[model samples]
Target: MKKTGITLCLLAMSVGLTSVVSAQTQLPNSDFEDIQSISGVADNGGQPYNYEYDSLGQGWISGNPVNRYLEIDHIFMKDTSFTHSGSHAIVMRTDSIGPVVAVGNAGLGEFVFNESNPFASIVFGAPFADRPHAFAGWYTYKSVGGVAPSDGDDRLINGDSLLILCYLTKWNSTLEKRDTVALASWTSSETVTDYTEFMIPFNYFSSDVPDSANVMFLSSSLGYVADFSERPFGVKGSTLVIDDIRMHYSGAGFDEYAELNGTAYTVGKKVVVRLEELPSDASVRIVDMAGRNLVSRQLSDKESTFELAYSGIAFVIVRSEKGTLTRKLYIH
Candidate 1:
C-alpha cells in the first residue's frame, strides 16, 4: 500500500508562484460537467492506433499520457451514466497498455508526462491557502482482477482499493523546502453500486498558513507498485466513479474556529487586529476570499493593522502556540 510520503521533489520543482488578484475557497468545475475532447495516436504493438477521450474540463489534470510511443490507455474519462448530480462525473479505470498496466489517477494541478523518463513525470499544485476542516465528495467503485502481464509476471489480483487524498503545503524559507501543513486521506475496497457521500477531516501538523493545496483521486491504492522497469502493475477493469467534490469549512474537526483572546474589525480600508495577550510565536495573516494572502506578519505588539487594496470579504487568521482564530473582515 503506497502512502502519502512519496517524494514530491519533482512536483515541488514544477511549482511556480503567480499573483492572484482575487480568490475563492471552492474548486473550479467540481461537477465534472465541463469537458474537452482529446485525440491522439498510440503504438499498438508495431502499428499506430488512433483514439480520443474526454478529459476533465479545467482546474483538474490527469496522468494519462496520450500520443505516446506506446499503446495509449486512458485512465480518466467523463462518465454520465452514474452521477450524484448534474449530467456528468469522472470515471477512472485501471487498464493494460502493452507492457504496462497502470491505475487511473487525477489531481488538482498541472501534469507533464516525460516519455524518456516516466519517473520524471511532473505534477505541480495550484495556488490555494485556505485551511478547510474537511474534504467532501461522492464516489462509487467496483474492483476486478485478472490481467496477464506482458513480461510474464503474475496475474493481477482482485479487490484492490481506491484512494482519495488531500494535503495542504507551505514553503519554508529557512529549510528551503515545502512542508505539509495538513493532510486528509481515505481508501476503501468495498464495492458500491450507488453514489455515496464521504468526508475526510484534515489533520493539521503546523500552525503556519499553507500556500498550496493538492487533491488527488486514484482507482487503486497500489497504482504506484512498479515493476523492475518502473512500470506500474495493477489489476485491469477496476473502476471508480466520482463527482461533486467540495471542501467543508465548518465542521466538528475544525480547529480554526477555536476561541481566541483577540478581536478583528475593519477600520476604513484597513483591518485592525488586537490580541489580549500575544504569544512569542503568534502571527497574523490576512487573506482574500480566494485564499490569497494580503498581509502576513508576526505580532510585535498587542495591536496591529493592515491596509487592503481591494474591497469585499477577507479572512483574518491568527495562529499561535495556544490555538488558531479566524475572523471575517468586510471592506466596502
Candidate 2:
C-alpha cells in the first residue's frame, strides 16, 4: 500500500512539471466515445453471432473473421453507464474469458489479418511525427484462471494476458517496417480488477527521431494459441478496458526506485542502484521528481552500480539497445 500510494502521489506532483511540448495526437477515437453501434449481429458460418461495435473504422483493425481467422473487440468492459473519462472507454475481450474464442486487438496504424500465417498478423506502423517520452493510459483486466496464460507440452490452461506495444520507427518503404527507432512492450498475466494507470516510457534504440510509430493493444497476448503448432495461449474469457490513452512530451522526470541503503528514504537524498547484465552502451540517468536530469552515466560492464545523487523520489531511466527500465529510488 505504501509503495503504490507514494508512487501515485509523486506522479500527481510531477504532472505539471513534465511539460507537454506538443499535444500527442490522440489515436483517432481513442476515448471510444464514438459508438456507431453499441450492439450488432454478425454472420459466423451462417450462424447468428452477437457482438458489440468495434473501432475498425475509428482507427483500428482486426482479423477478417468471415474469411480468415476469428477476431472482434470492445466487449462492454466499461461500466453500464460509467466511463473512465469521456462518455465511454475501449473494451477488449478474448475467447478464453467467455464461451467464444475471439481475438481482441486494436492499435494505431494497420493490422494485416493473415489467414495462412497467424504470425503474419503484423500491424504496420502508422504516420506519427512526435517524439514523446512515453505512452500513458488507464486500463483494467479480468480473467478466469487468475493466471497469465502459459504454453507447455501441447496443452493450454486457458490463460489470458494484455499486451501494449509502442515502437518508434523510420518508415522503411522497401522492407515495409519503421526501420526500428525505439520500442516498448508491456505484457502482464496478473488480473487487475481496477482501472490502473500505465505509462510506456520511450527508450531510444538508435537516437534517431522516429518518423512513425506503431502502437498495439491486445486482450490476448498469445495470438497463435489456436494454431496448435506454436506456443500455448492463455485461458479464455479474458477482458480488458482501456481509456484516456495519450503520449506525453515531457515532465521534469519521474522516479522508478525507492530504497536507499536498504531502508525507506525521502526524496532529494542519495542512494545506490545495482543492475546486472547491462550492455556496454547502456545509458542510465537520474532525474528529479520534476523530470529534471541530475545524473547521467554509461555502463561498460556486464554488471554495474550507480550512486544516484540529489534524489527525493527520483527516477532512474536506463536505456539500452535491448529496452528501457525505470526504477523508483528514495533517499533521505
Which candidate has the top score in lDDT? 1
Residue 301's lDDT within candidate 1 is 89
The deviation in Å at residue 49 for candidate 1 is: 7.8
Ten residues in sequence with the least summed lDDT for candidate 2: 1-10
Report the lDDT tens digits of candidate 2 across residue range 194-229.
778888666554555566656666676654232434
Tens digit per residue, CA lDDT, model 1, 1-332:
00111111122122533323233386678877776666767687998778655566665766653222335445444445777888777777777555455667777766555555544454556677777888888999987755455676653444667778777777777887676666666667778889999887665656766777777777766565222344555567778888999877864555453546878999889888899888898888775532334787898988998878868766677777787666766797
Q: Model 1 reaches what TM-score against the true structure?
A: 0.62
TM-scores, in order shown?
0.62, 0.57
What lDDT score is found at residue 40 in candidate 2? 56
